[model samples]
Structures are given as structure tokens and as C-alpha cells.
Target: MARPRTPLLSPDRIRDAALTLIDAQGLAALSMRRLADTLGVQPSSLYSHYATKDEVLDAVANRVVREVDTSGFARGWRDGLLIWARSYHSVLVAHPNCAPVIASGTQRREQFLEMANSVHGGLVGAGWPARRATEISGAVKYLVIGAASTPFGSGFADDVQVYLDRYPHLSQAHRLRHEANRIDHDSFELGLTSLIRGLEPGPGQTE
Candidate 1:
């Protein structure tokens, strides 16, 4: 061939390969040697692009956030929050295994900052005071991430009937799952709505 379209060990390509490995094998299985072997390149070549595994993991973590559409915030703060929450949920659900990477907070600096700025700006523009905006954004981040990482089962499935009998409240909730095989979007939306609604200003509150 005359010339390759791109470098054999570019950062983007490296992150993509690493992500695929992570998605299939879990984070513990990753290593420079393993990635290089998978990429058909020398392990040293990987160092030229990423000096350590953490850098690669950061890229993979940020990749999930990079997929979210922050532009939804432009519509208005409440709608913006809802849209961003939905986008975040979609990405994490698709790559549940990668949740810890993002949860660890070792994201690529630039992308994370850009995302934070957009959320803060959107809220301020929509009439939230600065401090409150920061707090609300933080709460929303945790809620969305928590929802994403929540296990599908209540951990009572092994003896669900017995457990349900003891916990009347849980029994009421368990009845709803009979109609579904997995966590449904309606449940998430209900929580999301209640959360955003709670953030609404109360009497005597003025920004």
C-alpha cells in the first residue's frame, strides 16, 4: 500500500480498541500488552499514544459522556435536565460495565469541563441562582448515574415471594414487575420528574 489512512497507533483508534475490550471483558482484563496484541502492534507503540492504562481508561470513560447531547439544555432548564438525563441513561445502559470508569471521576479533563459548563450555563440562563444551579446539576448527575448503575434485580429474587411477604411496601412494587422483564423507562421518568419538580423554587424564593 502507498500509505495508511491514519497512524497505526493513533489515540482515537487506541481508545476505540480499548473500549471494545472493556465492553466485552471488563476493566480488569485490560493491559497494554493485551491491547497491543489485539491491535497487532507492539506494546511500545501504545506508549507513544497513551503512557499508562489510566489514560486509556479516561478516554473510554469520557467516550460515554461525549455521546450525550448537552444541546438539549438550550430548550429550557427543566426540559434540558430531562433530555440530558435521558441521554445519560441511554449511554450508561448500553455500556453498564463502563459505569465504574465514569463513576471513578477520572474523565478526560476537557470534555468533562465542557459538559459541566454547559449545564451550569443553561441553568443560570433559565433563572437558577449560581449556587443553586451548581447544586442542582450535581444532584442530577448523581441521580442519573445512580439510576444507570442500579441492578435490575432487587436482590430478593432468590426468595422473592418470602421477601415480598415480609416487606409490604416492596410487595406492592414487586407486583408491577410481573408485567415486565426489565426495568422500564416509565419508572425512571417518574423519578426524574419528581426530582426536577422538587428543585422548583418554593414560596419566597426568588433568583
Candidate 2:
């Protein structure tokens, strides 16, 4: 039999296996041993590819980031930011398990940082100061990750009665705009656009 161009002992395979495990059950379910078992190899053998589980997870984190469509880069910076934000939200919704792991610094990998840097660099090059660019980039990143990390039922009053009776304002708001209260995908983009609009620099604004 011919060997596949990509060999079995490859970063891709290891990272995929780890990601599958994490995405399926949760990150805690994926130990080195579990990953090795899934790969049909011994745990010690995996050490050659990933010295520790964290290394494997870091690779997986980057793999998830790879799914993001940065093609918005060619469309101009604002479009780029929206595209990146939407891509991020899509990826996280597909793999909710990875959001917290990515956000929590359990494996502080460089791919995400590099992505952030690209946004910040574009903004700065477009006349925003480095400090303001960083803020905008950070805020955009937070908007996606923070929204993704929030559990579905979270932020709402756990006690339904409290949400309805005591919090009349909250109840009315929910009743008035049920769609907005739903945490739907459009909500994220709406918030992202608003953030961009708020931070849009004035005529030739800079530090």
C-alpha cells in the first residue's frame, strides 16, 4: 500500500483528534492517553508530536482559527472586521466547547493573537493610533469571544418570576423585542457594526 502524502505521525492528525475529542465531550475528556487511544498509538509516542496535551490543544486551537475567513482583508478594513467577526462567531457556534478553552488561556496559542494583530495593524495603518487600534481590535475580539463564551441560559434571571415581576423593565424589553432577546446571530453582527461605527476615527484622527 502506498503511504498517504501526509503521514500518520503528523501534526494535522494529532490536532484533529484532539479537537474532535474536545468538541464532542468537552476539553476535560481529552487527556493525552485518550487522544493517543483515539489515534491508535501509545501516549508516549504522541509526545514526539506534542510534548504535552497542552501543545496538542494549542495546535487544535489554531486549527479552529484556520476555519475563519480572513478573506475580508481584501475588501477594506471595515468589511474585513465584520467578516472576521462573523467568521469567528460561526466557528465558535460550531464548536462551543472550544470557545472557553480558547478564551480561558488554557492554551494561549499564537494564531489568535496573530489574527488580532492583523486587525490592529490594518486599523493603525488606516490612521488610527496604535493605542486606539489595539482597543478597537481587542474590543472586536472580545465581542465575538465573550458572546460565544456565554452559555445559552446565562445572563437571564434564573428565577422566571423575578425576571417578570420585580424586573418590569426587563420583562417589558423582552416582551417588546423578543427577537433581540433571543441571542440570535444577527445580534452579534448588529453589536459589531455599532462598535465599529462608534470607534470610526474622525478626519485623519491619530494619536
* Predicted structure with the largest TM-score when compared to the true one: 1
- Misplaced by over 4 Å in model 1 are 1-7, 153-181, 202-207
lDDT of 1 by residue, 1-207 (tens): 333588777899999999899888977878888999999888878888887888888888877688887888677788888888888878887787788787777434567778888888888877788898888889888877877666454343655687676787877667655543255456677778899888756213322
lDDT of 2 by residue, 1-207 (tens): 244475557778889888999889887898888888998777787877777777787788888887887667566667778888888888988887888777876424677777776777777666777887777778898898888887443355544565687667777655533354265566677899898788644318432
Model 1 TM: 0.80
Clashing pairs in 1: none
- RMSD of candidate 2 to true structure, Å: 4.7
**Which pairs of residues collide in candidate 2?**
none
In order, how many clashes per candidate?
Answer: 0, 0
**Alpha-carbon local distance difference test for all models:** 0.77, 0.75
Tell me, by lDDT, which candidate is best.
Answer: 1
TM-score result, candidate 2: 0.77
**Could you tell me every candidate's TM-score relative to the true structure?**
0.80, 0.77
